[model samples]
Target: MLEEKGIKPAVVAGLSLGEYSAFVKANVLSFKEAVQLVKKRGQYMTDAVPLGKGAMSAIMGLDRQTIKDACEEASILGVVSPANYNMPGQIAIAGIKEAVEKAGEILLEKGAKRVVPLQVSGPFHTQLLEPASIQLKEAITAISVHEPTLPVVSNTIAEVFKDKEQIKDMMVKQVMSPVYWEDSVRTMIDLGVDTFIEVGPGKTLSSFIKKIDKTVTILNVENEKTLEKTMKKLAELEA
Candidate 1:
């Protein structure tokens, strides 16, 4: 719709599974393929971890190294690592429930401002999701992927995907690797993306992008109202 007004994304990206949407926008995956692949991806992840065994938590106001050290210390209990680096002072950790809780405690003791546990199905974006990665690789390989019409940033490596061939491996590694959202957003800024539009249901990405770089224009389209507002903002930017 924005294209009709001579506006389009300079580069595309999303958080976690949201990456699929970025791929769709970049023409790496057709809308239909994205839907089917996402469904199977969900199924595989559910099958990978039993409910209550895995967990995630948001550790706020802590440095990356502090959080990493806490997770490493807590790994004695089970798998635990930094799952998502959401913003400057906020990072999410995931792994076995025991380890996550333990890491949270350690982070707090280490002077973290807050360690808030998240209500999630299973420990995503960690080694716990390895099974899901393997399954997703096969599913993605079955599809007809094309090189991106525009750059699509990857969450795992915090870099733009190269071509059709990189998608499967990137997707496979993504499931078990931490999402460098903060880094990805920085990469976009370096790419000269002065504006961002979060085209989904929530403004979480908008919030993170704002934290990463306040100067960039951020917009969202979740409903009719937001779409109208976003278009108005884009029009003004264009003007």
Candidate 2:
């Protein structure tokens, strides 16, 4: 689906498993390696916490500070913390079920537009996932990772991996750090990337990019038809 579109991402970024895909695209690892790493990551994360003990929620229409305050205000029963800072008004918070629920209530009371609970096994990007992060760190150093052909922005800092050592460290930290998604998109724009092609299972990334900059040419390629269309558009741009 990706190759057909000629939408080779100049700077590939991913959200969770999407990071594995980005690594594969960047030739840092083979397809088999990517799959193996993700599988191991999933297993480690799952084993770190008991099943049904953790959860995530998307609190929209609220800024980061507001959401942070809400999480801090509602930090009861379990660890509620902001996971992914998707955009100015969109953030995903993760922690124990009760803490997440309390945070959601506080946000809603404070005029948050909506709080949607995510279907996830563990509280990703939180201290609750530190055990998984530690285990994953060992696995990352053990694996063979090479520099990407182009800049690969990390979710944790929204910065491109410029140093091999940083790349190695960021991989582990990303497992338990808030994804600086908004900053990443902004940085890409600042670097003159007017076009964004999200190659994945859904159009979520593209949607977020649009929210970041409506004028940017953003497209999602999930099937043959979209792939063909994207290729045609890319060709036109080249012409």
Candidate 3:
């Protein structure tokens, strides 16, 4: 739709699984290859950790460093770490079930306003997913990748991917690395991205972007109504 309307983004980025969409949009991976790769990737991740062994939770009303420290403190019990820095006060932690539970308690004790456990299949973006990362590396090695037409910011380093040869490695590592969402958004803002249009099913990303920079224009298109609304809004902006 953006193409039909002659709308071009200054930069492109995605969060976690959303990165694959960015890759497809950037022409780095074909639709077929992306589907095959994502299927195997999902399997590898599901097999990496047994059901009921791993868990994830959202930590609200806490700073990044404090959450990191809480995870580090909880690590003594088992694997636990900050998984997603979603926004200023919203972060996700993932690891062994026991450790995650412990971390949740610690976070609340440290003055966190709330700690809610997430309903996820397993602990993602933690060292426990390293096995999945390894498998993903092997799966992607057989596929061909091209340099992105537009820069795709990585969740691992919060940097633009410049080397085509490194894309595979970045994707693999991304499976086990915390998503630097806030940092990635800040990087785009630094590059002068004043408008963000999330092309997905939910408004979760838009909410996060708003928290990061409320002054920026944010829009999401999930259906025809939203699409029309967003197009009208963009026309107004352009006018």
Off by over 4 Å in 2: 1-7
Compare the candidates by lDDT and give the number of the best one: 3
Full-model lDDT, candidate 3: 0.92
Residue-level lDDT tens digits of model 3 in 1-239: 77777877778899999999999999999989999999999999999999999999999999988988988998988999999999999999999999999999999999999999999999999999999999998898899999999989988899899877778889999989999999999999988889999997999999999999999999988888888999999999999
Q: Per-residue lDDT of 191-231 in model 2, one digit per residue for the tens?
A: 88899988767888888888889899887777788888878
Local error of candidate 2 at residue 213 (angstroms): 0.5
Worst 10 residues of 2 by lDDT: 1-10
TM value for model 2: 0.94
Tens digit of per-residue lDDT, candidate 1, span 56-109: 999999999999999999999999999999999999999999999999999999
Candidate 3, which segments miss by more than 4 Å at Cα? Answer: none
For model 1, where is the 10-residue window of minimal lDDT? 1-10
- The alpha-carbon deviation from the true structure for residue 87 of candidate 3, after best TM-score superposition, in angstroms, is 0.3
TM-score of each: 0.96, 0.94, 0.98
Clashes of 3: 0
- Among residues 3 or more apart in sequence or in different chains, the pairs in candidate 1 whose N, CA or C atoms overlap within 3 Å are none
Candidate numbers, best lDDT first, in rank order: 3, 1, 2
Candidate 1, residue 233: the lDDT equals 87
